[model samples]
Target: MTQTLALVGAAGGAGTTRLAVEIGATLTRTGRDVAVVDAAYETQGLADYVDTIEADVTELVTDGAPLDSVVQPAALETPGQLSLCPARAPFERLARAKTAGAAETLEKQIAAIALSHDVVIVDTPPVATNQAVAAVDMADRIVAVTPDSERGADALARLSGRVRDVGESIDAVVANFADGTPQVADADTRVPATETTAPSQCPSCLDDETAFAPAVAAAVEAALDTTVELDFETSGRLDGLLR
Candidate 1:
């Protein structure tokens, strides 16, 4: 069965979307079929970072579109492919979809996408939003991303408590753009910051060649309680990165 991993930003600028893309790309390089979903409706940042179809996640909740129709191949050209189910609609429109049975419908669409792929990486918006909460509820494991600052750490604690309150376990916590070491006792595993400069094209998407990618993939693997493999190209590949 496919596993869903939700990469959530505990606060703004935590590099959740970037980490999601990097992890998805790394998993692909390791020969896994991966699908990245943009659940960040307000920013639609994932769509900007990757090649996407005209449709968004909201379309999957409506009557006219099929899940595959909205799914597009990400630009990552690894031996294994990376696909994306992008969200491009305005926030108000997406908010409406969150009501009634539409959210459940959206969850079903996401579940179907998971069934077809080896792993599904959900790039969520900052924690505490309804969209983020819904994604967390659907996820098998949550990888909460935060910055190295005290505010970031505090925000992560709040988000972690909220997730646990709902009976979901946070598999890992990644501190992005860390200038120095950041510690937290709540995380099962903590990934140190690797990238300092931002990418020119997408603020969140990191180049696969960067050391950041491998470090994150290894950390996420460790969070999943699997043997950590530091190699990005060869040995540390998980059958399902989120599993």
Candidate 2:
């Protein structure tokens, strides 16, 4: 069975996108065909790490376009063997892509992609938007990305309620931008927290140690008990090291 995983943020700067890339890359390294779908149209930096082709999923929904035509292969600097569907250009394309019959259209496209791959990893936008909500509805497993800060925890609380309302469950909570230690409340019991080094310099601390791909691989192994095989050029390089 193909696994469809959605990585969402408890709030912005949760490192959800980074986690998605790691998971996709690891899966691909293991000789599994993996596709990374970027749903966060606004900021699409995730496409840069891998070979990315522009896919207008919204266009597929609105115009009944072919899903294959809409998907573009991302460009990976190194050969990691992963495919990517970049978020639409101009961002608004996603909102416009949601046609009256968009739900079914999007699902069909995703199903087709799933058939061609062992795993599909979706990097979703922040939880409040309808697009983000739609992605969650389509996911087999949802992973929430949070931080160790108090505000981050609060955001997770609110996001958790939203997930419950949608009748979905979060498979894990990745503590992005973690410092010495992360403090998660007892009430948030859906998933345990995984921590990595915090990103530095970047405004969102997006490039911190938490952004490391291997750390994410470890988290996935812990969460799913799925062994991963990676091609490592070096211990720390995120790009060459594929599972």
TM-score of each: 0.81, 0.73
lDDT of 2 at 233: 37
Clashing pairs in 1: 18-204
lDDT of 2 by residue, 54-89 (tens): 345566666666677655554333344566665555
Question: In model 1, where do residues sit more than 4 Å from their true spots?
Answer: 183-210, 227-243
Q: Report every candidate's CA lDDT.
A: 0.68, 0.61
Instruction: List, in order, the clash count of every candidate structure.
Output: 1, 17
lDDT (tens digit, per residue) of candidate 1 on 18-121: 77776777677667788888877777777765454677777777554877788887665566778877777766777775664675776777788887788888
CA error at residue 93 for candidate 2, angstroms: 3.4
- Give Cα distance to truth, residue 16, candidate 1, Å: 0.5
Against the true structure, candidate 1 reaches a TM-score of 0.81
* Candidate 2 residue runs with Cα over 4 Å from true position: 45-55, 74-80, 98-100, 185-213, 222-225, 229-243
